[model samples]
Target: MIVVALRARSSWHKPAWWATAFGAIAVATYGILWATPVVLDGMLGGRNLLTLVRDAAAVAAVWFFHNAVAAQQRKPEKKLPAWGLGLAVLSFTVPFLLISRPGPTSSAFVLDRLDQFPVWLFSSIYIFIVGALAARAIALLSSEKTVMTRFYVLGLSLMLVGSIIELMYLAATHFGPTNPDFRESLYYVAERPFFGGIFITVLGFLWVYAVRVFWKHLARWTLRIDARHEGGEYLARSLATSSENGWSDRQLAVNSAVNIRDRLKIGTQALSRREHALFSGVEHLLSNHLERTPR
Candidate 1:
């Protein structure tokens, strides 16, 4: 229980994972905020509100990748994680029936044109949209991929680009007949760009966020490597200094031996000179004694 709770808290710190989680949540939460514009009488504009939610969701999802992706692999596999992926895929299919298909045949209804689809169809569409986005939230936050984690950063980056393009198209088209030049426009084009772009460009934030998370992981490993290498080098230098000292000592001993040898030679020469002088004095005294005895 402690580990689970700790993991949950760490999840938000991951910028990429957070964005992704938020994006998924926004997709689901659209139901509650979708009609906010009608009751409040512009208390909160529809487009801006939806854009904010969507962008917020995207940011959350990005953070999820950062916090959980690396750690997810270590957890035990449960049946619930598989169910999540299925739900996410199902969500995508519902939009096909509710929103018009991209090519041509898919049925799509404008939000303003409520008469086009029955109430039941709208409800079904909402549920599916929520499921689809929620699935992404669950999949990214809960699952752990080993090889995929090793390589998927680039893939996720590409996926973000595709999502942004799709979101841009949706935002551009999901408009009412309100002209900005007239008083009918709830918000200016500039406002929509920031709001809508939140969903699309949240990916850019995710990219930087991904880099930051990975860098934190990379930094610790690098510091250890540096410390080990530095220590080894220092030890080697000490050994080299010791070797140089040994050479200096050897040179001093050789110089002392040469000085001792020179002193010994000078002492021997002085002793020989003293002996020669004593021998000459004794020979002169012996000759005088022999001459006096013969007389």
Candidate 2:
């Protein structure tokens, strides 16, 4: 979390920080709803309000995560329409208004008495959110070579799996009564996997933050360049490779010279030393190139 805050100084990490913040808020809201004992007309108002807030915040978290990662892509990323966002928020009300009573109900009643429409609506929104997160994570995993990007992918993947489990369990509670044995077993085992997923997600975020904060400094200190006697092109290529592989500094110094040596191993091929020096002085080409890289 501290790392996220620190990284927020850069434009690239701002959205990521916001995503985390919103996620935290959603979690807190859920905790409040579960623990509080306030009674509001014994029905739809308080519980529904809390649920809506949680859902809205969750949606914002996913949207921000997608936005941050997508900004790094070369091509524009797919976006949810504004109306689509509104619809997602609206779905939270369906369960409160139709499927669920203001107070708690028995598992049997929830399954047999309530309609499945609201349950499916709730599940679909969660699936869509997690699906979007998974897709973005996959894209980043495939394209970005950085180790930290993998951690980001891992975190999103964990959340996706966890969400699916929770959704399935919820569905089962509603429908599992059709088979009494299945319902009982599912009730016992359903929540365990969900927490495991949450644990992994937290760990993954820690790994991602570590890379974001320390990887650059570590690379800068550990990298050993042997281009001391090499030609300008050789040095440039080496630095370019390092930068592409996330082994170079965000800000680098580049220098070229007038009387630079342009000899090959054979000490042959003469070229304009000034031009070579100019190119050499330019910072690692990869640094320049990365301006366009979604990383």
Candidate 3:
């Protein structure tokens, strides 16, 4: 007699990434749908509203690792994760300060672009930086032995390159148009290649290398493991929209400190004492409930 055994699902095989991807798409969608209303308009304080969403995505990425993305039996990092998340939440305020207050002096440095581009552009960067840092933390979990590889280092490097571009753009308005020759070269570089240009190109190659090596292992989880379980099969269903609905509450729970995102995504217009207390209360409740759930 031949028999088929239904395998009991492991905790790691759950729909966490699906939820993470969902939240990412929802924000990206919010950004796209409201691009004109929130991103392009600074007259009615829409820019700050957009900043809220950007920061929330950052906080969400941080929380994802904290709550859903970690390995089974693995511990989260203590320091770098905090730093990554802090910068992500803090990055939201950069635009508000640039746009708020009296005169052009509030944007004392090269942050003029805060006024020029929609907040979503920079917010996208903030989210990516947060994700990169979080990925580095995940990679570092195995950094002690031979498994400690180039992926973490590469992620750090990409985050630095993107950060430098952001900082330089803030410092000078002519960053992209520095010189006709440089613009032509860089523009062409960005068009054909993913990262493009000299430094970014180098980092791009490194990112690919890191992705190749690290994802070779991660693909086991992303693909090979999917072959083994129903939940994994669910996760594999959408490359664009993973089970985003799965871990959203988890995202919010870990990022309760990241009020910037909480405000924007939830569209909290003003945080009076009552609203603040309510949000605080809700976050506290969620945190407790999250601690109990298996996901």
lDDT of each: 0.38, 0.52, 0.40
My TM-score estimates for the predictions, one after another, are 0.27, 0.53, 0.35
Q: Output the lDDT of residue 94, model 3.
A: 69
lDDT of 2 by residue, 1-295 (tens): 3444565667434666777777776766534554542332124344344555566777776766676566546344554445766666676655545655534422233334334667556655655565566666566566786776666666666666666765676665665554656655664464454445445655665565565555454333222222444545765675687567754343322111211222322344333466334334332343443221111
- Please provide, for model 1 over 194-258, each residue's C-alpha lDDT reduced to its tens digit, 9 standing for 90 to 100: 34434443454455456555544433332232233346564345335535774332232232223
**Which stretch of 10 consecutive residues in model 2 shows the poorest summed lDDT?**
253-262
Clashing pairs in 2: 72-294, 254-281, 255-281, 256-277, 256-281, 257-277
What is candidate 3's CA lDDT for residue 261? 33
lDDT of 3 by residue, 180-280 (tens): 45534543332232122223423433444355445333333323222323345443553323235543323423433343333435564345575456445
Point out where model 1 deviates above 4 Å: 1-80, 88-92, 98-114, 118-295
lDDT measured at residue 272 in model 2 versus the true structure, 0 to 100: 48
lDDT, candidate 1, residue 19?
42
Candidate 2: regions farther than 4 A off: 1-13, 30-45, 79-83, 104-117, 163-172, 176-195, 206-249, 252-295
* Candidate of highest lDDT: 2
